[model samples]
Target: MTRADYVMPSNSELEAATPPLWSIEEQRPRISAVDLFCGVGGLTHGLVQGGIRVGAGVDIDPACRYPFESNNSATFIEKDVNELSGADLLQHFAPGDLKLLAGCAPCQPFSTYSRSGRSKKRGLDWQLVLGFGQLVQELKPELVTMENVPQLADHAVFQDFLGHLDGYHVWHSVVECSAIGVPQSRRRLVLLASKLGSDGLRLDTGDYGKRTVRETISELPPIMAGEQHAGDPLHTSSTLSPLNMRRIKASRPGGTWRDWEPELRAACHRKESGASYPSVYGRMEWDAIAPTITTQCFGYGNGRFGHPEQDRAISLREAAMLQTFPADYKFVRSGEKIQFSRLGRLIGNAVPVRLGEVIAKTLTSHVKMIFG
Candidate 1:
């Protein structure tokens, strides 16, 4: 026979021809899930740790592929989700097997920062959520979950999307991350939907008093200004210019540029034009949780990014830890130098692993109640 004629079947075809790979009768039922827009695979990592098998992750950013694959042991497909079809998804997951779809699409269009001053431009970014909705309608996964900035709940398109999932019992709430033991004051809208249950889905909130900044990052080895921690790839700090070093030296923990002497203040800070922006040049307090981390977290001028006690901005590793990624999560390849911009985006965009763990645990409990 020709080699072409004898070619082996792909994994999907073999899976379909064979009996169910995992049988609930013979073993503990494992909930299978797919993560869309899976940034850095934080949710995927947590889901796997929670006993849910993550089949694959889909994202448009190529930068996310390495960390996603490296950290989660899941396949990462770099493609715009709008171009994907139901057949593509069915290849990984068998029909009639318990299916779950989880996603937290880019929220820039609905973000509070983006709304500050700009005319609304509708385009592919706006269509992302609709694309996600279409996939849900086609695949009809038994359960669905999503997380995003609470501002998204105010959008009309988001409201319509919720209405379309009429057959599924859905529960949504604007959850405070601090209230969920995340150690930050960030608030996000979380939604859970189930087609199999009439009681709807709700995540249990644990006692919120356990986690704090001191408890989370206080124990790590300290690095000085413009220094990276030894043997820690993500613990690299940004270099400060001489003038900025003076400013940083004068900066008090939890204070802003207003604390500086008149001669040391930035010109814009003294001008009426910059009166409205108060968070710039601010430092975090060691005793309290840090401010909301953003994509520009490595830059000193970006929000309240100054280090609490150090004279430099918080390092990339600190940012990741604040996002609830484990201390040793591999952000870059071994022997490769870490790039701040690449690492910053990966850290900022990730769903905090701890938060994902909480969500996955709750969903798994729900699934076990029904099918286990």
Candidate 2:
């Protein structure tokens, strides 16, 4: 496919197409939410698709503004989570609608604190998750939900977060993204708290089955290492070093450094320290799901990001697709140069759109049970 075959819309075009939140006609007893730490509208998009209304998205990054607004039709507020209050979120909800406050707080600080044995006195970064709880307490939003790394379930802060839900019935579980149609082996801690009643919310078993890498992206035209597809700039791959190119060529699907000839293997892999780290610098299996897409997933040496049959790592667009973003989803505006770092971070950090849709579906069912 060529660029002409798929023209990304202009910023103005997307804005004009997006209906203002305030102008949307009210449905009686409807559910609307404001997404906190909403990176590039993944959850918002899924919520919209699941038949919920999203009024706005709040995040600290200015770069998130365009994609969050343009794709989701929700107002994107560029502000830190700590700076926000219930009033800031309350303004976004339609009068009489069930207010749902949803967020995915950053978990990096927890990892940092865990390493230092300072889990109790966590820094400002750890406070962001608590800030979500703060908003919940102040707004008393009828429904609340949060998503994060599954490992967070073991943290003291996670327990602290639960303490804020005194009057709410809550349920949380680790959700496998592939079960929800995301073509990646991603698992997330999904939590739901409701003020409505005793019967707690639960996610329905997904029907999608495990989607595979080939199924998700095989239709796209091929591009070599460091080459861009003429039809899709986002389909561009990073250039591999000559040695790395040789390494990738020697690598096999689902295979590790063991698959490579000794000369093609990295020096680190030659050491005992690397013996336990076989998952890195490997190619994805065409029939299997992809590894967790990380911020550096565009790089050939990062995780199992190499393409199954192609001699280069997967492209930025492929990574987004594995994250369940639509082929036409716009991360950058038309003619804006696509930076691998910026786009990769935005896509990787986002809650998979499919998982968000699953959350929305669960919440919508709960709303119906209460109101109807």
> Could you give candidate 2's per-residue lDDT for residues 70-175 as a string of tens digits?
8887899999988888887888886545689998997665442135545544566569988999989999998898999888899788999999998999999998
Highest TM-score against the true fold, candidate: 2
Candidate 1 CA-lDDT value: 0.77
Q: Which window of ten consecutive residues has the lowest lDDT sum in model 2?
A: 19-28
lDDT string for model 1 (120-151, tens) is 54455568887888888888887888888887
Model 2 residue pairs with clashes: 2-231, 3-231
TM-score of 2: 0.89
The list of candidate 2 runs beyond 4 A from truth reads 1-28, 110-122, 198-200
Give all TM-scores, in the order shown.
0.87, 0.89
Angstrom error at residue 223, model 2: 0.7
What lDDT would each prediction earn against the true structure?
A: 0.77, 0.84
Q: How accurate is candidate 2 locally (lDDT)?
A: 0.84
